[model samples]
Target chain A: MNDLIQTGKYLLIISAIAGLLLAFTEMVTAPRIAENNRLVLEKARREVLPGAERFDTLDLATTDDAGHPATRSLSLGFDAQGKFLGTVQTVSPKGYGGPIDIVLGLKPDGAVSGVKIQSMRETPGLGTKLAEGFLDKFLEVARAGHPVKFFVKKDGGDIDAITAATISSRAFCKGIRDGIKVVQEGQTLIQQRAAAPGATPLPGPATTPVAPSPAPAPAPAPVVPPAPSVPPAPPADPESPPPAPTVAPEPPAPPLPPAIPQGGGQ
Target chain B: MNTKELTKGIWAENPIFVIMLGCCPALAVSTSLANAFGMGIAATFVLLGSNLIISLIRASVPDKIRIPVYIVVIATFVTMIDKFMAAFTPALSASLGIFIPLIVVNCIILGRAEAFANKNTPQDSILDAIGMGLGFTIALAMIAVFREVLGDGKFFGIPVPLIKDDPCLLMIMAPGGFFVFGLLMAWKKHLAAGGAK
Candidate 1:
């Protein structure tokens, strides 16, 4: 009993000292760590929305169409002269291996300006290809003012899925759709905050809305002209003939034709 | 203190090649030289700090609770390093990921504390910690060099001449890690035996 008491006493002392040391270290490093994280987020935001001199995160109190509050903050970007550039929002959807965080920038008129992947834990060679230019197609489609399609060609939608990584592709699309929703719902609030002088930020609501299913093509007619326009200019440049043909054919042909045979074989 | 306490960990009792300790991280982070070096330095920092503190409190620590006390000391050091790295070198911290936190359970810090720090004086404990830490670092670097060279055809992120275009990708994968580890262990054993003869 005496030995047990002695052991407990020594352990307690050691633990107490360790705890105190850790607390001291945390006090010193907490602010710096927070700063580092903020810098990383800022860098990602800038990449998605280039030319924005600064950003202001609007505290939107309004709920979505489903009546639940938004979970993400809608950041409004401004130029050097303080003109409104667009809105930047981040959305993380469950990917094949894990959640994929995507940062998307939307033009003031709701066109997609750019997209940057914040972080992902998908498979290295297969699912990770989403970061390597696979997402550029989505950016192009968004810039052309077409409704972002969430499914692959096999599912009666236009977006081409990554080879052998359908799940990751679907997750990436879902994250973009969710980001668009956040931008759409918070647009009025963002405008109001920007217009008013020193507006008090409103707190976000408690419950986050469940993201709704992909809505019917908002404007399908505009998509057809952009598709042909994308291929012609690059191919006309004789200096880059090899790369143009390879790029044009690979994006449209390889995924669709082979997908039918591959799906049937499986 | 004799130099044997210091020199022994480098070759004769290398924490990875000979003593076969901390192999999980040895394989996990050896995919890149930068990661290997970062992990090595972080482990060294923790080992140095833990050994020093444990030695200072060796006598006062009760025998029955020595392990827990040592753990508390080591974990505190690991957490400190983790936070410091995250603050100063966020990119490296992100790439190293979970391995940084796993340093708490490395076995090397605790092993040295129990085998040497507890019994030895503070001066000798510091020396032993340094020797073991270097041994661990060198072992990790060696594995990383071979893995990075053959797997990615790159040396410290620079592409090598002939091998750059068509490198053997398997060398960076899990099976390749086991193969290289086993080969390195065999080579080390061969050298030890030849030196003995």
Candidate 2:
């Protein structure tokens, strides 16, 4: 009886100490972790909706495909002049392996300006192609105009599948199509938010929105590659070819895509 | 500090190659040099902290409740380090992803607590912790070098000439991790057997 009591005391003491230490660590890291997450979200916003100098998040209560009530949020982007640029939103489409998280930037006309895969669990070397040249092909099809079938060529759509990764390709298309629909639905709300005066400063870099020129094709101005030490300007070459699509490799290794800024940026 | 405790883990009884305690993470993160270093350092921090605490309380921890006590201590350290890394080193945190949280279950840590720190002095335990941590880091780096260079055709993210354009994709996959891990284990065993004499 005495040994049992003693053992109970020992366990209680150890757990209490462990809990206290964890609480202390949480106190210290909570703020910084929050800040880091904000920065990451901001960066993703900029990457998707290039030239978006200010953003307003709109919570949209809508319905899913199953007609269930789903609340979705949209980050409406505006230029330095407070001119509406487009909307950047994230959507998860069911893929072969699992849900494929994709962030998309759309022009005012509902054309896809940029596409980035936030995360996915697809087969490597195959489904992973959604992050490489396949995205470029996707953007081309998107810019071709609305009424896109949003299916693999095999499924009677315009976009080409990543060879054998047809399901992943199909999922990518579905995510874009869904994101575009969200933006279209929330267009009025986005314009209202943009019209509100005294909007907050842009996320990170102070670079003002480039060229308010009226062009249907908003340059997918790649977020200046998060290198503050170097001059923000890229060498002016007429034919450098748009930067290669961010490489998202397969699982078990290099799950990170080069698009992600390394520790230096962090 | 005893030299044997400090040095044995580095080569003679490497946690991965010989003792073979935490091969899951070793193989998963060995796909890239950067990932290997990130995981190694994070695990080392957890190992060092847990070993010290376990050693200090080893005597008082009743044999019946020792395993639970060790787990509480190990988990505390892992969560603390995981939170710190995520807060201060977001890039490394992002790169390592789920592996950091998973360190709570890494056998090398609990293995050391039960096998070495439980009966060892605090001072010797510290030395053992450092040695074993270094062993884990070196072994991970060795695996990462082959996997990244051969599989990805790159070294530390920089493209290697000739290999960069057409790297062997298979090398960066799970089969590749197993292949490199097996070959490296065999080589380590061969060396331990003194050139297979």
Candidate 3:
């Protein structure tokens, strides 16, 4: 009937008007939403690299070992002075319940500057505790200035995994280690590509570190020093004696794990 | 236009407590009164807009695609609200998280469109939406006040007079949401039944 056609026309007009109103709203909010996301990412950038006046981005390709997840080129951020700040990689690890997204700040020397939880979906008050001060423990151990490259106390890492939330803790630790590995892999790939006939040799720190090994503190499991464990300073005039003899061991904990010079002298 | 429908929305047909329409926010943002207020206003705006649009086109919409049409209208509004909040109220937006975008799916807006707008005139639908949205906002605000006062020992981050002395940590948890909703529902039903006498 003609009435049915008129009804359809009205419906069409009404929906069109509604749709137009929504489109206008989307337009108004689009810029603001984008700014918000940028602000958040910037805040995380600041947390990971404190005193960073400005940040610069570098491209580094990353691929998983299984070859399933292939992200071409993670970003390496730097401060205003062009000093290497940290590589901003979305460290996605299988968290307690789901995926935990984190951004890791790696110093030029390979030690972590800081780690920020970008996003996560874990049980509150339980697994969520992993987001609390858990990453800070890794940072504290890293204040010694190195990456978290091993396991928990029970398994033998420098970090204290959250009590009762081992899964969340491990998830965070693994995210950093793996993210670092990806960057390393990318750097190698770039270096190799540069050596090729058509490529420009990339200028970067040689992956091979050349230095002496730093002394690791007494780990409960292995009381033996990983290198030269400095003997406790004598109680008398500790500062006056000066711990300069330990200097040969103090500078190599992070980058020299593989590149320590032959020192039968130790 | 009439008081029956209007009063029904305020209590008998309450969108949240009795009907439990927007439960996502009920459980999600009730941790703090500020967050709850933000969510309540967002939902109310969506409800008001959708109700008006649906009622304006009620006669013309084909039954087959009415739901889809309603969804589009709701989603558009939600996206707008989401962007605005992100830009202007960054802190509250972060606390609210994804619930803002998820407002498109809040059952209260769609429920009102289908149940009331489809049968009512524009003015009546508008009134119904306003009354029901206000009711939903009040319910969420009440739950949020209780949780924030007990759980954090404060109101809107200001230390409550005596709550800080003995705060209840339980009110801020997921279980607290269920407890508040259940208690409020029971109390509302009791009052309605007793008033009938």
Q: Which one is best on TM-score?
A: 2
Q: What TM-score does prediction 2 earn?
A: 0.71
How much is A205 displaced in model 1, in angstroms?
30
- Best prediction by lDDT: 2
- What CAPRI-style quality would you assign to candidate 1? acceptable
Give a tens-digit lDDT track for model 2, residues A26-47: 9999999999977887888898
Model 1 spans > 4 angstroms off: A60-70, A90-181, A184-266, B85-99, B195-197
Against the native chain B, each candidate's TM-score is 0.90, 0.93, 0.86
> Per-residue lDDT for A1-266 in model 1, tens only?
98898888888887888889899989988999899878888988888888886676654333433555434566777665555677788778899867888888876655577888877766543466687648877666556545545556666555688755789888887776666655554443444433332222322321112233343322223211211222222212133222233323322221111111011111
Whichever of 1 and 3 has more TM-score, that candidate is 1
How far in Å is the alpha carbon of A206 misplaced in model 1? Answer: 30
Order of candidates by TM-score, top first?
2, 1, 3
**Model 3 Cα lDDT, one tens digit per residue, A1-266:** 77678657756776687678777767787788788767787788788867664443433333454544454334445344334444566688898768888877755445566788876765433455566557666677766633344456665676687645678887776777776555443433222222221222223454333343443321132211223322233212222233334332442244223321111101
Pull out the clashing pairs in model 2: none
Could you tell me which residue pairs clash in candidate 1? none
Any residue pairs clashing in model 3, and if so which?
A60-A73, A60-A74, A61-A73, A142-A145
Model 3 lDDT per residue over B1-197, tens place? 58676677778888887887988767767766766776677777778877887798787677866887777666766666666777788886655544555466678988998888988998888888888887887888888888889876879768898888887877877778789878988888889788555
All candidates: interface RMSD: 4.3, 4.5, 5.1
> In model 2, how well does chain A match by TM-score?
0.60
Better of 1 and 3 by DockQ: 1
Candidate 3: C-alpha lDDT: 0.63
Per-residue alpha-carbon lDDT of candidate 2 for residues B14-75, written as tens digits (9 for 90 to 100)? 89999999987787678777778877887887889989999999999999999999999888
